[model samples]
Target: MPEHSYLGLASAMHRLTELVIRAAMSELSFPSLSGRASCGLDAACGNGDHSIWLAQALLPEGQVTGLDICREGLLQARKASAKAGLADKLAYIQGDLHSLPFRDRAFDWAWCADCLWPGPKSQGFLGMDPMPVLEELVRVVRPGGLIAILFWSSQRLLPGHPYLEARLNATRAACYPFQEGGSFLDHILSAPVWLHQAGLEKIRGQTFVADLHTAVDGQAGDDLAACFQMLWGRAMPELSEADKAQFERLCHKSSPDFIANRPGYYGFITYTLFFGLVTSRPR
Candidate 1:
């Protein structure tokens, strides 16, 4: 699992992605609640942003339970839920995604965002097999329920200044390797196959691009630059001193010599959401 402290930048990125997904979900005519109160499970719920959003969207009698392995994240999640006036509709628990603590058929639907990927321990450093996790989600969701998995596609650096682009490429190469001759995005794109093998029906996937570009003087630009800086700092152990310096210069939003001085200073990250229905459990 990623460290709890990583949520700051991650939360920022997630907020952007969630907005895109929320719009898509609305347009797709997602199912509406029936007679009984609707309930949902947010697996690996992080800071509970998604849980709260789910509750809001599924109202008037909807509730969401959020679970994560990171206690600190749940703490923040609880706080955010309270601040959003969604405390009554949202609940938080700390539990591993591999073996969820919920009972069979515990939720009407289950949601996992960026949590199905292999962790750091499995072969190729690609993480563990996601089958167990998917199975667990299947077990917890009632028949006819829905399961949604959202993840980021490989990042594409919009054509920026030459120096900045080179540094960004080097950073990406150092941080992410093409495991088994495929990039992380390739692995994510294969999730529908996993869902099928897990016995899910009505499996479907769609990609969304969140345009994160902003002018250097704007808050959005500063936030995105900060996220890049945080990522670079986390990868410092694997980065050369020269690379680190270059990243620092480029990510420094306030620096007069920053890369944003070049023409067309903007950034974007794409995300994809794959979802399926739990039609029935394997006998």
Candidate 2:
């Protein structure tokens, strides 16, 4: 992922899918989090997108701390939170996900987005064991508090090109968070089990979908283009010449047949969250 383009891409994605994100959050209940003193952590909160969401959700009282490994991202997050006038309720910090910077039971809850693990080693973040990272999340959250881990579970962007899309998805880049010899536990849906292993209780899962069925224009169109890149960015080596040509024809923003430009285009992606409660303090 290009550092220069992440903020814009992230911003566009947030704008495009905020409705579904909000809907997903609405279905979740954290009675304790609504209080004025409750403190929550937005783990790996990039550009403070979900951090702002958390802040708004805990409105009129609760405070949120946004933590990320990237300083640039935290800077952008600070700007964004301040712009939203949530600086009072939100704080930014630079820290590693593998070892959170806070103390034991520091927060009432933890909301982790697609940041629990790194992407392919060939990409920006060197892929590593996520168990330690998850343990850190559980460590900082208080007993009886909530811990939520979210993932970009699936995407259906290349309409009418299921085969190509399937192949693209099969590529190593698409199957993220996969270990070289990983088991089913490596899958995103296995998050509940992760929480269970980390000693969380009431393990459960839910998925939220962001669908683009209507007209997509201007920045949204470009953002959709960026989404295409992220989904199948590194599949060029795996795709045949013909497949590559077809991918460019349909996916590239400059192409006349770009999916976003076509009439009645439909694409949807899902964000799934697996949450559980800390039944007892970590020993």
Best by lDDT: 2
Residues 16-103, model 1: lDDT tens digits: 4566757645533334634566788989887888788777778567889999877878999999999999999898989887778889
Can you write out model 2's per-residue Cα lDDT over 59-83, one digit (the tens) per residue?
4677889988789889999998989
| Stretches of model 1 off by over 4 angstroms after superposition | 15-18, 24-37, 122-126, 162-186, 230-246, 259-265
Residue range with the least summed lDDT across 10 consecutive positions in model 2: 117-126
Q: Cα miss at 183, model 1 (Å)?
A: 9.8
TM-score, structure 1 vs. true: 0.81
Minimal lDDT window, size 10, model 1: 119-128
Candidate 1 accuracy as lDDT: 0.70
Q: Would you list the clashing residue pairs of candidate 1?
A: 118-127, 119-127
